[model samples]
Target: MLPNNKIPEHLRSWSVPWPLYMPTFATPPELQPGPGLDASVAAGWAEPAFFPAVNDWPQRQAAALIPFQVVGGRPRNPSGRTGYTGRRLGRWGENQAADPIVTTGAGADRRVLLIRRDDCGQWAIPGGMVDPGETVPAALVRELREETGVDLAGYRAQILTTTYVDDPRNTDESWVVSTVAHYRLPETSPATAGSDALEARWWPFADLDTLLVAVADGGGRLYAAHRRLLGLCGGGR
Candidate 1:
């Protein structure tokens, strides 16, 4: 329910390392994404290599897209626990969605389209959820319109590689979830509509960081996704 960008200390791996955090939780059930999820609850996959322990990970159902990480716990500080209070299991809701990285040309006057997130004051590509039954492509286009107000039926576009975005969300010491990600693109002269965004317009590459960006996750994956988009746009220095 809280803004994901402001990841809580406990829910964050930054709290502690995996070696100390992995042993803090009770055993959990296996949960995988798709088909078995209720409309309100969606499951995601776990890469076995993510865990240092040899236990079987349960398929999980998270409310949204979030990354899960193994982190160590604190003792006698804020919560005033004695010692080793078991590991903290944490992750974000794994939201599966397509990011439509629409770009215009990069001539001296070129620019890329972006949407301002009123919630966090961050800039994010026009993207949203993958509605059930609708293919990714359609969902991408539809979400672009809903979020950034762009429709590309008659525009030139390309579907980039499929990617996964993991943003850590929960801190129950009993559950975790990892979200998946994808990308789509349509080239145009930076056009956008819809009141969902604080403002939508063409942004020069040089001023990208100045904008408050609110994409799903962080780390190299997030940076790399934008980098790949720049590569697709072909005007980065």
Candidate 2:
């Protein structure tokens, strides 16, 4: 069972603005931190060492220094209030992720590879969390292979952008930041869905504007975060 972070009774009314409305929630059991807590710390909580304020971590590609203020021993989400405290995310601070944008053809004829995510059932670029000890470039390649069955390790990839994502899973204590890379292929490549992806397929680059408009209007099949990530890839204007 997961530990619950319950909101106070006084704060439970629907009249409360969403920013002020704290919801009772528990991090999913599967995403719970491992049993690595210090002897002095409580069980089911992340170790203090993982926190930026607790440790002097040198900035690296996999873990960039996205600033966050620590309050009551927890990192505060830099983007502002996210209702509840504690984290629905696995990490206590910045969760690093990598996105790979693979494309073929050029200009009007270009097509990009995308995957249908099992979690949200939205079509998104093939990507995943950057694992411990993995470089952002390596994570990009690995995630591409795992989600789309594309092997682009031999091809040159260009780093497009690295920025904090406005993911729904973000909380007051944890949030996601990602590095996006672009891989250009001379021709179409074979792609098969695997890992957390339900399906993988190619999409016309020109259609991204339409997709982005639909997503912005709140009725699209594209993942929310990917809308921003894809824009960094020169898509959707």
Candidate 3:
């Protein structure tokens, strides 16, 4: 992907294959991170309510690091544009999210953890943004706890995959990279709905495909990228 492609005017909003663009527009003032915009500040509009105070994160670990160019003092999506420019999203450049694929039960009774997101009301893997100065694994653990109240205290996580997510919420300036990790749960581990989740539960691995295909048909919407990640899990495909 070219670094400075201009974002097309019409090919935005969940384009099947996102359009290529060299960003030529200036970033709006509200999206720009200023002095007080650190880890706790909201950026631009309010739908995405939890933008970090600071967004000047240096290169760190992520599933994929998309090459970007500065367009009007902001990192522009290099692969292409998603049309909407930071409409409801928090960060301007890369928003790193980590998902923990926690599982329990054995064989036929096996199930994987899932959380219903408060924003989109879709069943999704418990995850959240990577805070600055935090390692990817630590961020994964913290986000998992904040969203689902599941603690993988002594569990060692194996990174399953790292890749750029085709998030529906992405815009020309905002994109996401997801790092998915596997964490097997002890038979006794407990999970409860917490933080930004509306509900938390384990789903039988056998039912994963049905759920993914039915996401838009009322079964439940799974976050775009998450659906793909779940396919990598055993039987979920």
Best by TM-score: 2
Report the lDDT of model 3 for residue 82.
Answer: 52
- Candidate 1 ranges beyond 4 A from true positions: 1-19, 22-93, 166-195, 209-237
Write candidate 1's Cα lDDT for 124-222 as tens digits: 566655654567677767877776666667654466555443212222332222111333343554455564566676666655544324343321112
Each model's lDDT comes to 0.43, 0.71, 0.67
TM-score of candidate 3 relative to the true fold: 0.71
Q: Summarize candidate 3's per-residue lDDT along 17-45 as a digit string, tens digits.
A: 54353334434444345543333254332
Ranking by TM-score: 2, 3, 1
What is the TM-score (0 to 1) of candidate 2? Answer: 0.74
Question: What C-alpha lDDT, on a 0 to 100 scale, does residue 118 get in candidate 2?
Answer: 81
Better of 2 and 3 by TM-score: 2
Q: Write the per-residue lDDT of candidate 2 for residues 40-146, one digit (tens) a residue.
A: 13533243434443443334322454766655565666656555555655566788889899999988998999888887767888988887778988999999999
- Winner by lDDT between candidate 3 and candidate 1: 3
My TM-score estimates for the predictions, one after another, are: 0.48, 0.74, 0.71
Q: After superposition, how far is residue 206 of candidate 3 from its true place, in Å?
A: 1.2
For model 3, the local distance difference test gives 0.67
